[model samples]
Target: MPRLWDETVDAHRRAVRAATVEATAELVHEHGLRAVTMSQIAKRAGIGRATLYKYFSDMNSILVAWHEQQVTVHLEQLVSIKDGPGEAGARLCEVVTRYAEITRSSRSPHAFDFPDLHGHEHAVAAQRRLRELLGELIAEAAQSGAVRDDVAPAELAEYCRHALAAAFELPSDDAVHRLVAVVLAGLSASDARS
Candidate 1:
C-alpha cells in the first residue's frame, strides 16, 4: 500500500479502537460489568462486531484496554505536575492530592473486581514510575528541610503511598485534603525537630 494509504488506515483503526473502548466503558458504567456484551459495545461504538473483535478478544479485554488507557492518562497528568514549577514539598503535595482524587474517582468502584488487571505490566510500570517520582521529590524536600531526613527517600515514598491510599475510601474531598496534610506532617522535619 502507498504511505498515505497506510497512514490513513492506521488512523482509522485507532479511531475505531478508541471508540470501541469508550463505548465499552459507557455500557459497563450504565449496565453492570457482567451485564455488558460485545454486541452492545459494537452497536454503541457504531462498528461491526467483527471489527470490534479485531481490536479486542472479549469484553474483559476491552475493559482492560480501557483501564490501561485511564492509567496512562493519569500517569501523564502526574508527570506534567512533576515537571511544573514549584517547591519540592509543594509539588509532592500537589501530586499526592491529585493522585488521591484520581483513585477516588476511578471508574471501578470496587478494586477487587479486576484483581488480575492490577498486576498487568503497564499498570506495574506506571506504579513504579509514580514511586520513583515521589522518591525524587522527597529527596529534594529533605535537602531543603521541608521533610524529615531520618527516613530514606524510598521508605518515605512507600509511607506516602500507604497514607494516600486511604483517599480511595475517604468520604469527601475535605477528608482527602486532611489525609494529605497528615501525611505531610509525618514527613515534616521541622515538626520532628521541634
Candidate 2:
C-alpha cells in the first residue's frame, strides 16, 4: 500500500498549501503586506510555525503562491466570460467591466505591484496567455466594426489590463464603472453614434 500512502501524503500537502494560501490572503486583506508574517499566517492557519515552514519556506514564497492563485482565478473568470453569450465586443466589454468591479471591490493585495506577483517565468507565461486571449477577442471585435479600427488589438488589450489595475485604486465600484465606461466609449467604432 505504498502507492496509497503516497497518495494520502500528497493529498495532505495539497490541503495544507490551500489552507496556507487562504490564510495568507485573509491576513493580507485585513492587515496589508507589511503586517503579515509567517508566524501570523501559521497562527491564522491553526498550525505551528514548524509545520508552516514545512509547507512554505517563508512569507515571500507564500505571497507568491497566493498571488499566482489569484491570477489563475482571474484568468479563469476572463476565459469564462469570453466563452459566454453575445458578440465578442459585448463579451469583452462585459469582461472588462466585471474585472474592474471585482478588483475595485475585493481586498486583494494588488496595491504593491510586486514583481514576484506576476514576474516569475511561469506567472509571466500565464499573463502572456491572458494577453493573447484578450488580443484575439479585441481583434475579432475590431473586425466586426464594433471597436475602433485604428487601435491595434494588442494595444487595446494592454490598455484594458492597465485599466483593470487602475480600477483597483478607485474607492468605489460606481467610480470604477464610470472610468471603465469612458474607456469603453473610446473603443467604439468611429461610425457609431455616441
lDDT of 1 at 117: 77
- lDDT (Cα, tens digit) per residue for candidate 2, span 11-85: 988888999999988887788778788999989998899999988888778877877787788788888998888
Residue pairs of candidate 2 with colliding backbone atoms: none
Task: In model 2, state the lDDT of residue 189.
Answer: 86
lDDT by residue for model 1 over 1-194, one digit each (tens)? 69999999999988998999889778767877777889999999999999888888887777778888999999888888878998988887889899988877763554456547778888898889989988988899899878899889999999988788888788888988898889888988877676
TM-score (all chains, Cα) for each model:
0.90, 0.79
Off by over 4 Å in 1: 1-6, 107-116, 192-194
Off by over 4 Å in 2: 1-6, 30-35, 103-118, 191-194
Backbone clashes under 3 angstroms, per model: 0, 0
Supply candidate 1's per-residue lDDT for 80. 89
